[model samples]
Target: MSINYLVLVAYLVVTFLVCGIPFGKIIARARGVDIQKVGSGNIGTTNVAREIGKGAAALTLLLDAGKGALATGLALWFFPAFITGGVSVAPHGDAAGLEGLVTLAAICGHIFSPFLHFHGGKGIAVGVGTLLGFAWPVGLMELAIFLVIAVASKRVSAGSVTVAAILGPVFALIYGPNLGLDLLLELAGLVVVWAHRSNIKKLINGQEKEFSFHKRGDKPEPDDDTIGESK
Candidate 1:
């Protein structure tokens, strides 16, 4: 058996399990409540953040992101030749590009993980981390966009959706084709956008809740009508 085949297999196995098992367990344990039961009913970091608090939420975010990076990094470490292919007639033929593919696989596993019954988070943190591992410049851009939108709208959903949208073409333009990283990034972006459709509707109707970073214990404000009617 060629080392290349082993490397590819390792990438697949690592990426799939990282998002599917460890993430689910960590998130579930941290919240002390089944993440699938709350908020958006998906066991992703966002719901966990809203339910648990910042510390746990941040942990979830970092773990989710880290796993993507870890999976890619491991593949690089274990199967250098397989990933790089080292100056071959075939295209892409490099460790960096192979690492990107691992990143994408991890993102997909995070978003639409089969172990979670196809229910998963929006993939913002994981996607960003994956990009950061594979392409640092693109990752920085993603963070910038996320921060800009998050501040401007005061909604985490808004920022997450925007970052996902930018990932597609940005990677393509940066790395170009033959690597297939762009297509993977685009697909991951699409999944994230789809996941946030409910949030999009809420934003359009002016019903989306803004995040309060400073007030850790603050809850979302009640509807104005309820308050006015009470008065």
Candidate 2:
């Protein structure tokens, strides 16, 4: 096997380990709260802000997103992109496809964390991190989309779903000609949506929690329904 294979394997393992660190749960526990037992039982930024303080929540968001960004960054640092003259760039071959897989690995590590016994966050913050890993242009676009929808709906889950659902295609458009990578990103997006299935159902049924923009806690008492996005 090529040295690239070994490097890829190493990147995957490291990414999984780092991204699996649940910053929200750890931060909440420091404040005498089991994040998983709160309104949504989710260890994402949203739940942290609700149960603890926005400060803790901010830390969670930064760390969660950081782990992912770190993982993806390391991989790309070792791997090269397929550059195009005009503007397009990224994989169109084996290394490129592997890069996509490595990016996916980052998200999977966060979602199916080994430390949490294969349970983890819904992939919003980490997803943002990976997009940024791919390229700032792609990452910024995703951030804008999440913010627009989230602000308009007053629900983080809404923004998360919309951005995740479209991640693969939009990413493909920007850096495609690599079908394998495109499909992997699409699947990653699907995984994000699946994680948010409950929240989506709640949104359709008028049960999802909307932000009160208050200090802590919100209206409807914030059911165990899920409240997180944009780490």
Q: TM-score for candidate 1, please give it.
A: 0.78
**lDDT, residue 150, model 1:** 91
Model 1 lDDT per residue over 173-208, tens place: 665564455666676787778777877878889998
- lDDT tens digits, residues 24-110, model 2? 889888977777766777778877777777788789989988887777676665555322233222444554566567667878888
Kindly give the stretch of ten consecutive residues in candidate 2 with the minimal lDDT sum.
81-90
lDDT of 1 at 159: 92
Q: What lDDT would each prediction earn against the true structure?
A: 0.65, 0.76
Q: How many Å off is the CA of 171 in candidate 1?
A: 2.3
Model 1: residues >4 Å from true position, as ranges?
Answer: 1-3, 22-25, 28-31, 83-97, 173-179, 213-231
lDDT of 1 at 200: 82
